[model samples]
Target chain A: MDKKIKMRAEGVNFFYGRTQALKNVDILIHANQVTALIGPSGCGKSTFIRLFNRMNELVPDTSLSGNIYLDDLEINSAQIDPVEIRKRVGMVFQKPNPFPKSIFDNISYGLRVNGVRDANSIEERVEASLKKAAIWDEVKNRLNDSALKLSGGQQQRLCIARCLAVDTEVILFDEPCASLDPISTAKIEELILELKKDYTIVIVTHNMQQAARVSDYTGFFLLGELIEFGKTQDIFTAPQDKRTEAYITGRFG
Target chain B: MFTTLFFLGLIIFFVGVRGAKVISWEFLTQIPRCSMTQGGVAPAIVGTLYITLGAILFSLPLGVACAVYLCEYSPKGFMVNIIRISINNLAGVPSVVFGLFGLAVFVKFFGFGVSILSGSLTLGILALPLIISSTQEALLAVPQSIREASLSLGATKWETIKRIVLPAALPGILTGVILSIGRVAGETAPILFTAAAFYMRGYPKSVFSEVMALPYHIYALMTEGVHPDRQMAIAYGCSFILLFLVLSISGIAIIIRQKQRIQHG
Candidate 1:
């Protein structure tokens, strides 16, 4: 089977005011695969992922020079609306930031924003998305309850359900499990693998084990640079770059 | 906090004890008679209500919109900082200065005249800085992560603010409004030149009619009336009524904020 590219970034460079955060880099995210980015703190992994959905533009005084494509469409072009780009490429943050609203509203929010106002269809999509995120069984009876009342792990899954409700082609997880306990982390890892069969995923994580366990392709980043990129198995067992090997072997972060 | 509460209680008590005798049902319902020494402060009460309501109606939407624009859409840098500083400075400007501005602009230039329309516009201007600053604070308090979540789901910036950010910041915004109501009701200087009549016979016929307000009425009763002792008592009653009106308005706002908090939680 030939793998197709879902997203591609070419010669991407990013700066926050005077400080360069991402050096010239190239990466490809394959369709229906989990691509994990592993790096230490401040390695620009999060920055790179944010660019996939144009999330980096939210920060003031930040600029990017790159060709970022969702399939064949250049997302950074002036003709493309970031709002439209974001609908196609959703994001789940490190922290489970649920709106201080009811569980139903939280999931339906994306659909409503995308101009889906039919009550019956919204209800159907909400339930389908919740089930897809594997949180429906836990929250089925309390859809009207405040999303904040859910546990941290449940909230993270609800966030994922929120992304899924939008029917995004690519979902970016920026350290989605960084704040979760081991059990919650395991649940999210499982969900990611399950989600990959339907949606292309890009996750940034500090846990090498997580990257190795879930991702088909893994990219290792270091100090604003792409240090290595290959198949997860090859990158872990036979890293081509010494920096990637040293970091993977726990020589130094 | 106790000290503040004690002073508030003492002031209310001091006025209530003296004013209780004058505050009959007739005092609230009847028009003033006997050269402002007899009858009720009905016109003053009605006038104060109109002006305050009008001020809120004028300022709330404009202030909240300004705050939203400044916080969400404006490019963050020198220009925004300057605008922020100017708003803060506007808040610090004396009420009398606003009265003069109202006298010159809304009264003279716009030809609204010295009536409820002029006074309300004056008080609205006086309240704008407070409302804008409070609203800005409220908007800023909403977590950026929530905004990111909304935007990531394809919500436009306006949609995010209107649906999410504004609702979340509502309690804080109401707090600002509550404070402004208190100030707008009690303020004598802003309404003195632009709105308040010395003594009106009946309820204002329209926004064009000059009306008597509680604060200015109280001031008039003490200084302008012939019967000093009787007028002094009436003034106390007016003060008490004014206090009650401000409290009730703010009470309603507080209740709204409470409901919002409960619903959001």
Candidate 2:
């Protein structure tokens, strides 16, 4: 079977007020595949992923020279609205940020904001999204409770459900499990494995075990450049680059 | 703080005792008679209510909008810095200076005359700086994470502000409003030149008509009213009423801010 490309970046260079963060880099993301970017801190993995949704523009004095394609559409063009790009590409931050509202409202916020005004459809979608995030059974009894009252892992799952509620074609997770416990991290990893069958998933993780366990395609970034990227199995077992071998073998980050 | 509260307690006790004899249901509802020596200050109370409400109505939207622009939209530049400095300076300017400016602009130049319209406009200007600063603080108090989450969910900037930032900042905004109310209610200088009537019959029929207010009424009672003893007693009553109004507003604002802190904690 021929794998189709869902997103692509070409010669992307990013600068934050004259200091370059991402050097010239190129990568292709496949449809319905979990692509994990693994690197040390400040490797520009998160910055590169943010470019797909135009989130880097939120920072003042930041500039990008690149061509990022979301299924053949140049999302970086001035004519393309960032808001519309964000609708198609959703993101979950390192920290779970649930709104200070009820659980039901938190899940339905994205739907409501996207003009889903019908009550029955909103209710159905909220339930469906909660189930998709694998948090429905835990929270079904207390839909009206404040989301802040939930545990850390539950809140992260709720954030996932929120992203799913928007019907995004691509989901970006920036260190989603960085704050979770072992059990919660396992649960989130399982959810990510299941989710990639329907939506393209791109996650940035410091945990190599998480990348190896959940991702199909893995990209190893070293100091703002893509050093190696291929099938997760091939990169983990037979890394083509010495740096990828050294970093994956616990020699250095 | 203890020392100030002790002085405040003493003053309140003294005024409360002196004014107790004059204050009543009739004193509040009946119109002042015989140069305010016999009848109740109904018109003054009504006038103060109208003017304060008008000032809030005029300033709240303008103040909140200015705060939103300053906090959310304005780029950090020399122009924004200058605007912020001017706002702080405006807050420091004397109420008497604001009064003079209001008299020149709203009363004489704008042809509003010595009416509620002029007084409310003047009072609104006096309250603007305080309202803006407090509202900016309120908007700033909302966590940036909420804004990022909203925007990441594809909400427009205005939508994020309206749905997430504004809701989270509402209690703080209300606290600012309560404080502004206290300032507007107790202020005498601005209204004296722009809107205070020496005397008026019945309630003000329109914004163009002059109206009596509590602060200026107290001033008149002490300085120019007919009988010294009776006027002094009415002045105490008026002072007590004004003190009560300001204190209650402040009390409510403090309670709201405390509740908000505890909730966030």
Candidate 3:
């Protein structure tokens, strides 16, 4: 089976000032597929994912050389506004960071910022996004209550709903479940699986088991390089890189 | 510290007891007469309120904007570091020096004369560094992650600051403003050369009009008046009122800060 490429990174070398982080990295993210980047700490997995939305550029003295394409459009080009690129590619952080506002306002903030001025449309989109993120029933009655009042799991889901409200084509999860419990983690994993039918998803997880369970394509990253990339079954059963096999088999990180 | 509180309490107790004798409904409502030893300091009270309110009107927006620029927009470099240090140093400069500076700029150069406009502008400048530093600290207290979340949702830098950062920092900023009000209300130096009148016939009708103020009223009565005992009594009354105003402002700010801490926790 052949999958259409949604995002492609070619020879993407990233630097923080003079220190290089990603060197000669290349990967193809398939449309409507779950791609999991698994690696130990400081392996540049998070950095690699942030490149898609150009989030790294927000940091001063950071530079990237190479092409990151969202479909046929080169996202890293000077002509492309980073804000416009970010609108299409949404991101959820490692920790749940709901705005200090009402649940309804939190979800609608992205819509409002993107110039969705009609009140009815904003309300409908906020509800639909919450429902899609599997958090509507828990928060429907208290949509006006502060988002800070919600539990950790609910806040994470609310963050996801916030991302969904913007009508993004690709959603980036940066170790989203790192701060969650087993039940919340399971809920997130299930939601990611459900989401892959409609939206392209990229997740960076420290949990190898989570990658094996939820991802269609698995990329094992080690020390700023893509050690292996293939179908999850093959990567788990027959990894081409010895480092990937050793890391997966519990030999070393 | 206990000894310090003991003396402070002693001073407040004596002033409160003695000042209560003169503080009547008529005294608060009526204007001063007979070299300010007969009636009330009503004009002075009104002047203090106008000058303080004017100072806040001028300073709050200017200080908060400067703080937002420093915290949100200014790049971290040698220049920013120098700016931060300069602001801190501005806070430490003598209030009397600020008074002279205000006299030179607002009174002489701007031709505001010794009017409420000149006084308030001086007090506003005096309060500025305090407001900026405290506001910057408040903005910094907001987590960097919230900013990233807003940006990830494609909100512009100004949007995030206006919608999220500013609201989150408001309680702290308000606390700072209230504290600045307390300082501005009791300050004798800045208003001395710029705005305070030795004696005024009526309440100030405009910012350009000269006005009487509590601190300056008390100062004039105690030092320069003919009837020492009578003038000293009125001065004590003015001191009591000033103390009450400062303490209540501080009380409100403390309550607000406490509530914010509880809400955030």
Candidate 4:
């Protein structure tokens, strides 16, 4: 099936105290297409992504004026529970947070929390999710080992597997491989490419090549503004904006 | 210099061992009977257990509840700050001052009147500050990430605390309790004015019954026109038993803590 608009954000302005974190940001994330938000540190790429899942609400003294649509649901509405929104729009953190549990338990945690009681079903789902994360072969044997004992790369994959196990339709990653080694980063990049076939993926990263390599539609953000939003090939090769050109060409943030 | 220090330590070690050997197994099992001064300390042994157990039961719940309230529920406000400050000051007030307070409050007003109930209440108050401090430390040591992670996973705040936070902090809290037990086991001053009568020859039958702990027995046997050798022997035996009890409790606590840590880590 062709990619479709899975979620949308319209005319969103976000502030941390008096300082503006995001100017008017409008973007549409399509199903089964990896959209990477690329910018310098503190340029609102991460802040914009955090809006969709309401992770930004955790910050005290922060305010938002916007409308975020998760499929047909109004995610930004006061009536919606952020926790419920998070279940649908699963987030993988900057650091690999594997829950200090055994590998099997870490994957099953989301399912268990959502009241998935049948052991047989949980086992099958955990296995399928791990395979989707491309980590089942490496970790399947030591399923009972503590997640902390896994390598950083493995831990990141385990987190992806955790997100998948919850049966989320969309996945948000905030610098998911920023702390990993190049090899581990490459593995995660590969995993990301594989994941984009099934789930709507939104990622915020500082790495330009990663944005170039992994994304289908790329949104170039600068100074709390969306500078360019279009196909990745167009953004990387022939960006319309002068700022996007300067940024992708290794000039300045 | 090394030899001088070593020799002094050696002498002390040998002296302690000799005392322990002299105050051996027979001293532990037999109920204290002062042949003119109570050669054994069985009554003192029983009294110490009663007071210590009662004090622990009273203080543990109160202290932990206060700590959990402070850590989880209390906002940073004037009342909370004042209560915290008062607890800090209470810890610094002299034991003798606590003794006097116990005398005025429990002994005279409540009519507990030189009984284990009054003594236990006084000791519980003494141990409360220590328990609160340690429990606070333990609760703080639970990583904030764990709580955030739990909450993020759709677990209610109460569920997160019940399942994740409490089990993790349990070791530190137990360590604190065991340490307080050691201090409570050795206390004499506060109980002297509150519960310890002149000379309790046997174990107390009820909470209100006047009790004789090892420390009180030790104190009285040292004075009050008693037979010098037998009195001194009983004191030494009681001291040895008290030391063993404290050490054993601490040792067991450490072992359990280490086991839990290894299992978790």
Candidate 5:
């Protein structure tokens, strides 16, 4: 089967002041597929994902070298606005971070910022995005209630709905289920599978089985390096690198 | 904590007992007569209100803007540390020195004269450090995740600050403003050389008009008036009114914050 590349990172190196966070890494994310990055803590999976939407720029004294492209556009180029890049590539963080706003307003916040002004269209899109995230039925009755009042799982899904509201082509999930219960994590995994029909997805997780369960492609990161990248089944069953096999088999982090 | 509250209660009790008899409607609404031994402190009350309002008007927007620039826009480095140190030191500078600076700059250089504008400008400068530091803390208290969420949705830095950060930090900022209002309303030295008329008739007609203020009035009544006993009682009355004014302002801010908390939650 042939798959088109949605995003490509070529020889990317990231630095936080004097410390290196991501070192000489290269990967390709395919269209309409879920790519899972798995590693122990501080293995640079989160750092690598943030490069896609230029979130690293917000951190002072942090620098990056190399090319990251969305389609054919060099997203890191000086001419490309981070705001414009973020419109195309959205993100969901590990902890559920809904703005301290109403449930309806939380979803509409993205649309409003992206210049969706019509009240009717905003309401429709908010409804549609909520439905897509599998959270509409739970929150529809209390749309005006504060988003913070929702359970952790619902808030996470609402964040996903917020990302979806902006019509982003790619959605990056940085341990989206890290703070969730088992049931919530399962619901999110199911939702990610459902979402792969339209949006390209990249998820960073500490759980190896989660990567295997939800991803088409999987990359194993070890100490700021991409040790192996292949189809999820092949990476789990036949890792090309020794480090990948050891980490997957729980020999050591 | 008990000792602190005891002393606070004692001071309130002393002031209220000494001045409660003189705090009638006429005493609050009428101008002083017979060398300030009689009549009301209406002009002083009006002047304190105007000067406090003016200080807030000048400082609130500028202070919030400065804090946003420092916390959000400016890159953190040695220079930022230097700037922060300078601001902290500015807060430590004596109010009397600020009064002198106001005398030379606003009163002499700008020719604002010994007027309400000059006093307001001085008090505004006095309030800036408090407002800036508190606002910076408030901005910092807004979790970074919320900002990232907004930016990830294509909101610009300013947009995120305006919509997310500022609103989140507003309660804290208002608390700072309330504290500054109490400080500004009670300050005597900053207004001594810049404003605070020895005795004024009616009320201030404009910002350029010199006016009586409560603290300076109390000071003058206790030291300069002919009838010491009468003036001392009136001074206590002025102090009581000033305390009431500051508390009411803070009370309003507390009410606003409670409403905001309820709405956001």
Candidate 6:
């Protein structure tokens, strides 16, 4: 099988009502590599990541005038259902949002919604996904307990496990550890490194060190523009743009 | 002044303590007849049960659906604006006006004259706006992220609504249902206009059977009846029962809301 570019966003200009959030941004993401989007808050990195799966489409008064491609198919057209694209492209939010249900049910929710009704299959897949998320050991004994009873970090991992259970092809994580503690953040970074071996991962983070640690390629976003895009090492160590250089040096975010 | 305040407090406390202590298993399980002095509140109790049940069944689905549209699917425009205004007005409409409306519509047009159906429909309409507003509040309280998360999980908008949004809002929706039930139970104006018969000696035989609700009976007992002792007894008994039912339902709704708040917090 030939490997393909998993996602591509070209000349994507997005706006919230009259205010433009992204300005003619373009990028190509390949399969099985972690692409880290680093930018200051409100810099459109989150907006850019959301556009890949059309999750940005949900915001009221939000508009997009660009094309995003997934597996050679244009995702911006009516022929492509946003819901279907979202299935193939999963999203984990900044806040840990486990359903107010049991651990097993939280992980199995996506599968159940997709019409998987087999009890044994759902149970097996939930365990496997939780194991992959590295939360199986922590929550195995408490599968029947309410997911809300878990600690914050455990809840975030449960969210990751839930995404995996849906069998998503590409995972979009928008600041998955921003609300978590440093220990939880480190754990998620480690999981992202492990996750990239099997799934294509795109992440948005404000932390330069996180991008340096986990990403294969890093895209630096500044003032709604893609200022730099290259191998993570190059962007952090030998960036070719002054704006990118200035951003990485901590002078300005 | 201090003695007066203390004596007043003591009287109120005694009444509450006596009411609580006096309530036995029979208070719930027994069927009231002529009076406890003459009989208990059997007929009014039965009428309350049927009317409240009928109102809930009639209003819950319609109320929740309306709320879902207002909160989730509505475009911000003139029509939604009009609907919001009308619903608010309907909630504020005098219970007497609701009673007259019920008498004109359900009693006359539907031809279910002086019957349970008429009363239930009137109560349902009266309660609809409340449930719709409460449900809208509940739906609004659900984080938009949860809906987005579900939709992005390959679920269609309806699927997301049915699965995540509704489930998350279930306890909240039940809060609305409970509140509506509490309101309907205490409603006497609509019932009087639509279904209050002069005298009902037997249990209602069918949906169209004209029945005597507790409020109407209390009204009749107070206004015209010769048995002052028995009538006053009935009034105390019915008021105690009605007050208890209303408090319980409202308390349950508050608890459900509190639980949801705790989870979200």
- Docking class for model 6 is medium
- Candidate 6: Cα lDDT at A120: 95
The parts of candidate 2 lying over 4 Å away from their true place are none
lDDT by residue for model 1 (A1-253), tens: 8589999999999999999999998999999999999988999999999999999888889999979999999999999999999999999999999998899999999999999999999999999999999999999999999999999999999999999999799999999998999999999999999999999999999999999999999999999999999899999999999999999999987
TM of each candidate vs. truth: 0.96, 0.97, 0.98, 0.85, 0.95, 0.93
**How do the residues B1-265 of candidate 1 rate in per-residue lDDT, one tens digit apiece?**
9999999999989988988879999999999999888889999999998999999999999999999999888887899999999998999999999999999999999999999999999999889999999999989989999999999999999899999999889888999998899999999998998999998878999998899999999999888968998889999999889888778878888888788677656
Looking at model 1, the pairs that clash are none
lDDT tens digits, residues B1-265, model 2? 9999999999999989998778989888888889778888888888998899999999999999999999999999999999999999999989999899999999999999989999999999888888999899999988887788888899999999988898889888999889999999888899999999867878999999999999999998888966888889988888888888889989999999998886665
Candidate lDDT scores, in order, read: 0.94, 0.91, 0.93, 0.84, 0.93, 0.85
> How many backbone overlaps does candidate 1 show?
0
Residues forming the 10-long window of minimal summed lDDT in candidate 4 chain A: A52-61
lDDT of 3 by residue, B109-196 (tens): 9999999999999999989998999999999999998989998888888999999899989999999999999999999999999999
Highest-scoring model, DockQ: 3
Which 10 consecutive residues of model 1 chain B have the lowest summed lDDT? Answer: B256-265
Candidate 6 regions with alpha-carbon error over 4 angstroms = A1-3, B1-37, B261-265
Per residue, candidate 6 scores C-alpha lDDT tens digits across A76-117 of 898888878888899999998887778888888899888899
lDDT of 4 by residue, B22-129 (tens): 575657656656453544566778888888998999999999989989987787789999989988987888887788888999999999888899999899899999
CA shift of B197, model 6, Å: 2.4
Clashing pairs in 2: none
Clashes of each: 0, 0, 0, 3, 0, 7
Error of 4 at B144 (Å): 3.0
| TM-score leaderboard ranking | 3, 2, 1, 5, 6, 4
Distance (Å) between predicted and true CA of A44, model 4? 2.7
Cα lDDT for residue A244, model 1?
96
Residues forming the 10-long window of minimal summed lDDT in candidate 2 chain A? A47-56
